[model samples]
Target: MKRPAPRTATTRHVTQINRTAILDVLREHGPLSRRDIQQRTGLGSATIERLCSALMEEGAVEAAGQVRQSVGRPSTLLRFASSARAIMAVDVTEYTARGRLVDLGGSTLYEESHTFALEGQDAGAARIDGLLGLVDRLASPETGVTAPIVAVGITVPGIVHEGVVTKAVELDWQEVPLADIVSARSGLPILVENDANATAYGEWHSGALANAHSAVALVLGARLGAGIINEARLHRGHRSAAGEIGFLLTSSASFSRYFTEQGDVDSTLAAQVLPFAAREGLHGKRIGPAFRAMMARCRAGDSEAEQARDEFFDSIALALVATSVVLSPQVIVLAGAFAQYSEESAEQLTRRLVGRIPWVPRIAVSDLGFDAAITGVSALTIEHARSATYLA
Candidate 1:
């Protein structure tokens, strides 16, 4: 399908709309020329030029450089200022971690991560303090940043209700005021999201499904989670657990159980999957080395590891296939640990998925790898920061 060029208009109301549209273009694809903006947005050349002049005057954007085409005169390119402002992106998931300083245009400046053991109430408190420390250090005037963290985007496992995390099954958190604590400590407007939903939103806004109207993301890490986006709004149902697909409980009792039969979840599993978990300041279980070795062997092509991977992914496929039937999204991106396993499983799942749904969403492994959460979280921060422009 052909995308129409941004509509160009001479009216003041249309110019206001174009202001938001121009920003979206630069945000999604930066350092664009006046011509590039006109093409992507379908706006008239004159209107684009006018808006660019006004935005420059308002300090919302700046002229970056001139673009030399293959066989034409250089075109002046405009881009969001790198120093426009910055936001904090905090990803606190069950299997990985990150805290980054991101700019309004979604560029990450600095980030850090490490392992952790977070479970129950006391652990949550400890994790919160640790995350605060990272924020303080990053936001310190000594860091040489152009701006402090004006907004925050955080992702976590389990169900988040308003600011309270009602049920983080993996973290064993119930009715916890997570957002309040983080907001108080950081002194920034905070937007907390379920990890999967955040990832899906990030992928969509980042143009992963550039051609599609909507997409779904299935993140397989320490546990399975899914996120859905249609018409650009996150489908967080009334309870705000819209993407909590982990608790769906496969028929395979073992697959459904979070811990081993012995009731022990090895720290290695935590290390292998959640090595950076603590650094994000999220609270969750910590697996030992034994679990890490097992996961490593699985990724390294060990036969036993292969079998485990196959079994785990096969069950995961069933859930995914089922979801495809319901949502029928344009694509389903597999992220986290499972992305490694998807190359082998995509075919199997596709073959078995025939006749199940009228249309099956294209299944592909996430190309973003471990950085999906961070990228998504960063996107979230930028989205909130630009809300004023969009809403106006």
Candidate 2:
């Protein structure tokens, strides 16, 4: 047998891995003495000291004073310097661009929201300008945040591939090079992700799904979108469309129609009571007030409103059954305006879902609400900043 070749040196790679490990430990466990880091990382005391010294010199870690031991000299505690750098996160919605300046510990340093007209001439350019202005406002010296911005993470309502928006029906955008354009203007590393995916990642990182092994975050609004997490990792399938559930067809209509047309609870209620409203000479009332009146009638035992409510529950149950069968997530998180439903509606939907699906995942309403996507993107930016330090 031929003699095996000698192993190539991997000292640098091992050192990088250990450095990252040390930083992660510090971040998770808070400040730790050098001895504590050594025990947690299984690295020798000398190696830990050497790495910690380098990190401290690089402004990635800092000594937080000393702890007196029982029998030996006091040991100095070290912590990951969470405020050493900052991240810029931008969330692009239908008509507003929201930005937040965040630190490594996921703390918001500053935030601003800018709204733009979506139907005027050069609307796309106006939206881009709005986003850039938001970034400029947050990153300016006037904000009093001394940390340098290391990266930008943008969450958009579209199919993003390698920082490009393949399609965003809401924005009427197609094949838009969003990341390159933003990077050119901002001069920082840029990452663009689908809004739903970002929200799911945000939930996984720090929200309701943080401890879940798998989850699906569904954004229910005029359009339906989903972000899937498997084994604690965001599952962006081939073409990054793993959770595009809007196109999934049901018996009544596509899932998107449920929230967009007569299938949605509010819209269905409006349609059912429109005849009643017209008969009562309430034709001038808008859908909002009509929806409220319909709900009131349902509470007062109106047969038509009750029928509409039952049909809405049935449609939602069918949609949930389809989603659960395919993804089988440990939990399903509901975000967007639909989360404002009354407790009775939630209970009814839950009962319907439990009756339809064999294994009913826990249904959760998002606490982050409108900030979920921005928060998730901010977390991604901080993660990128942390990785860059290791390379440095």
How close is every model to the real structure, measured as TM-score? Answer: 0.69, 0.83
lDDT per model, in order? Answer: 0.68, 0.77
Residue-level lDDT of model 1, residues 1-392, one tens digit each, is: 99999976667767678888998889779899988899999999899988888888866788888888668899888987646778888787543357888877677777776444554446655566666676677777766677656788878766777878776655546787877877887777787778788778777766454455767887765556788887657788788867655545445554644752112222223333343344344445532222234456665677865565455445556677667776778888776655555565566567666676688777776767667777787887777777754434
Poorest stretch of ten by lDDT in candidate 1? 260-269
| Candidate 1 displacement at residue 228 in angstroms | 1.2
Q: Model 2 compared with the native: what TM-score?
A: 0.83
Residue range 1-392, candidate 2, lDDT tens digits: 99999986598988889999899999989699988998899999899989999999988999889999668899899999998988989999767888888988888998888887656557777787778888788779987889998899999877888888888755657888988987888898899999889999998888878899989887754356788889888888988877766655554543534442222433443444456556556654233334445556778898987776676556556667888888788888877644555355557767887756678888887868777888888887788888988766
Best by TM-score: 2
RMSD values, in order shown: 8.5, 5.2
Q: List the pairs of residues colliding in candidate 2.
A: none
